[model samples]
Target: MTMRAVRLVPALIILLVALTCASLMIGSVSLSWIDLIKGFIRQDQTAALIIYDIRLPRTLLALSVGFVLGLSGAALQGLLRNPLADPALFGAPQAAALGAVLVLYTGTVEALSFALPVAALGGALLSVLLVLAVAGRVAGVTTLILAGLAVASLAAALTSIVINLSANPFAVTEIVFWLLGSFEDRSFRHVAMAAPFMVIGSLLLLRAGEPLRALTLGEETAESLGLSLVRERILIVLGVACALGGAVSVSGAIGFVGLVAPHLVRDAVKGDPKAVLLPAALVGAALTLSADMLARLVPAPTELKVGALTALMGVPFFLAIIARRRGAIAADAS
Candidate 1:
């Protein structure tokens, strides 16, 4: 690593630590640093309840979810050779959300807390399989992207239909909440529920890192370097789906962090794919944690959706990237 990159590591670590403490301390009811420290040590009951019950789990969930999304986005972007590619671009999140909605709208989720995550996993896996199947043999990046778009459109249409057909007001409200995304009232149980899948997914993506780096020069070049394109593609797709599915299942469709975080880190790190992953994950954690903090604090007692905040920030940034890319292409053409 360059000296500049090495310098960034310490800065990133400090930033992450600061963000974690801020997340723990700045909530609807503020807690002083001493109280926060005391809560962890069981020195104060009020501090204990607030820290243990509310802030800790929420912070952990945000970290875990952000890590998964950032890693997933980095992997997918690397695999597809498209900076704009996201886990959702492949229909994973939409399909997973649909699965959770199906269970909730049918009133089956209440009976089984694990049902929604399981259903979401199934939906995500199915979407990946469908995209691969449609792409068929000798599938190139363009074909895969087209196939993903088709699957995403289909999953979205199906989700809309389910929401529209649901009769229960409660179910509709629940579905809407899930779509908007929030970390409010999420407990350790939710953390425990999603951890395994996210961990597995992270491992899979990390394992593929070298192969993905080889792929940067193109499939033929990667193949010349003895990288199995097929296996790598499958691994990346499954890894992203597993990680992102668990996240969407738990937090409900928190968008843009996946797309934005990786890009920011890639630029900061000068496009070193391996170096980009962890920094992107840290940035993702920081972004989501800050957004969740804002979601709770904004509008006083009322909370804004975490996903809405991300989208609000992400859309303009996304547009700017698109515009710049277009301008670059035009210049090149000229």
Candidate 2:
């Protein structure tokens, strides 16, 4: 690793810590530095309760979710060799949303606390499988993307139908909020629920990192290096589905963290794929935690949906990426 890549670690760690503190400190009900300090020491009941029972879990959830999204996004981009590729782009989030909507509207999830996430995971896996079936071969990124688009469209249509036909007045609202995304009212239970899946997904992706790096040289060349393109693609898709689907199931479709985090880290690390993973995860955690903080504070008591905030910030970045890609293509053609 170069010195520049080495420098990113400390900087990212510092940034993550600062953002985490900012997340804990600033909220609707402001707490002083003393209160914050005392809360950790158990010297202040209200402070401890707010910090431990509410903010801490939310922060942890944001961190975990962000880590998963970032890693998944990086893995997807690496696997497909497309900067635009992400879990959301490939129908994972849409399918997960559809699953959650089904359970929420049918009132099945109300009885089973974990049903929503399980269904969402299943939907994500199903979408990936469908996309793979349609693509026929994992070597074709173009075909895979198109397949994902088709699956996403289908999932969206189904979700809309479910929302429209629901008789329960609250069902629509719940679905909308889940789609919009937020960390509000999230507890340790949610943290516990999502942690294992996210961890496993991260490990799976991490293990595939070396092969993904080899894929940069083209699939045939990578295959010549003894890497199984099919196995790598399947692992990547499954890892993304598990991590991103579980995240959306719990936090809704928090957009742009996956897209933005990995790109930012790649820039920071000078485009070394292997070196970018952990930094991407840290940047993702910081982005989500900071965004969650602003989502809570920006609209006062109204509380902007975290997804909306991320979208608001992310969309412009996405457009810029599109513009850059277009410019590059034009340059190449010229």
Candidate 3:
């Protein structure tokens, strides 16, 4: 790592820590530092319940899910050699949401706690498989992206159909709210359920780092260097499916952290995709925690969905990136 990257990591870690603490403190009834400490000590039962049972899991989910999204995003960008690549670009989130929606619609979510996430994971994996099959073994980036888009559209349409055709108004309401995405009232069970998948997915993505570096030199060159494009592609798809799939299973469709996080830290990492992974993940954690805090603080008694806040923050950045890339292309053509 370069000096800039070395500096960036610590900076991001500090920011993440601060945001985590803030997330713990900001909620319907904000707690002071003393209350937070007392809650940790278990001296204040009310504060303890609020902190441990309520806020902690939400905070943990924000951090882990954000990290997974960022890491997956960086890996995809590297694998595809596209700065615009996001975890959701492959339709994992939408398909995962569809899975959860099906569970909710079927009323199985009430009977089985694991049903939602399991269904979501199945959906996410299915989307990835569809993308891979449609793109074919020797497909290029454009083909893969197109395949992803098609799958995503189909999944989304199905999700809407499920929502529209639902007979139970309560289920529809619950599904709609869940789809909006929030860390509200999430328990440690959610954290535990999603943790393993996220960890495995993260490891898989990290393993792609060296190959991604080789890929930067072009696929033909990387293949000449003895890299297996097929293996690399499978590794990335599975990693994304697991990591992002797990995240979406728990958190619904929290958008743009994957897309924005990598760009924020790419410059500090000297545009090295390998170096970008860790820092982008840190940035992603910070962003999610910060957004969660804002979602709590902004509306006070009426909390905003964490996903909504992220989209509001991320959309401008996304547009700016597109404009910057457009300008660069124009300049190149000139």
Candidate 4:
């Protein structure tokens, strides 16, 4: 690693820690550092109840899901060689949300234990498989992107329709909340459900970096280096599906962190996707935790949807990137 990159890692880690603490402190019932310490160390019941039971899960959820989104984003970008690629682009989160909604709207969400996450995983896996099946039939990056985009649109439409058809007022409200995505009222159960799947998926995706670099030399060269294209593709697709699915199952449909996180650390990683994963994850954690904090602290009686804020920030950033790319294309054409 370059000196600059090494320096960047520590700074990002510190920032993540700071953001996490800030998040823990800013809830409806504010928590002091001493109280947090007393809660954990001295087992003060009320302080412990508020700090450990309430805030910790949300903080952890934000951190882990952020890492997963960023890691999956960097990994997917490496796989597709497209910086714009993200979990949302592939329909994983939308599909997962759809799955959760189906279970909820049908009145089975609570009846079947583990139904919410299982259905979500199934939906995400199905979407990934569909995208892969379609893209595999073609022979280019453009086809892959188009396939993912189509699936995402379809899944999102289906999710909206499901919400629309829900007769129960409470079910409709729940579905709407999931679509907007937040970490509010989250618990340790959510953390437990999401963390393991995310870790497994992250392990699989992190392995892609070296092979992805080899792939930059072309399929023939990468193959000659013993990189199996089929295996690489499967790992990344499955990895992203699992990580993103787990995240959405717990947090609803938080977006843009994946698309934006990698770019935040691209300079530190010197555009090497392999080196980008860890830093992107760290920055993503910091960024997401900060966003969640802002969502709660925004002075509105009701908290802002974390998803909405992310889109507000991310959409403009995405547009700016597109504009820059357009300018570059025009410059090249001239």
How many clashes in each candidate?
Answer: 0, 0, 0, 0
Query: What is every candidate's alpha-carbon RMSD to the true fold?
Result: 2.9, 2.5, 2.8, 2.7
Local distance difference test, candidate 4: 0.81
**lDDT per residue, candidate 4, 1-334, as tens digits?**
7778889889988888888878777778887888878877757788788778889999999999889888988887787666877777677788888888888777765722466777777788888788768876322545655787899899889987887888876777777877888998889988887777788888998878898787766667778999998888888888887787788888888888989999998987788878888888887787788889989988886789888888888889878886877755454344
Q: Compose the digit string of candidate 2's lDDT tens values, residues 1-334.
A: 6787789879888888888777888887888889989997889999999999999899999988988888887887787666776676667788988987888778666723677777888888888777767766443545655777899999989998999999988877878877888999888888877777788788888888788889888788999999988888788878887787678778988877888989987876677666777777788888888889888887665678988988898989988986777765455344
Q: Whose TM-score is higher: candidate 1's or candidate 2's?
A: 2
Instruction: Please name the candidate that would achieve the greatest lDDT relative to the true structure.
Output: 3
Question: Model 2 reaches what TM-score against the true structure?
Answer: 0.92
Worst 10 residues of 2 by lDDT: 136-145
Predicted structure 1: lDDT: 0.80
lDDT of 4 at 127: 86
Query: Mind giving the per-residue lDDT tens digits that candidate 3 earns over 157-213?
Result: 999899898988776777776777788888898898888888988999988888999
Give the lDDT of residue 203 in candidate 2: 87
Q: Give the clashing residue pairs of candidate 3, or none.
A: none
Off by over 4 Å in 1: 128-150, 327-334
Task: Mark the regions of model 2 whose C-alpha exceeds 4 Å error after superposition.
Answer: 132-147, 327-334
lDDT of 1 by residue, 111-162 (tens): 2387778788888888877876886644454566578789988988998899
lDDT of 4 at 238: 82
**Per-residue lDDT value at 181 in model 2:** 85
Off by over 4 Å in 3: 108-112, 129-149, 327-334
Task: State the C-alpha lDDT per candidate.
Answer: 0.80, 0.80, 0.83, 0.81
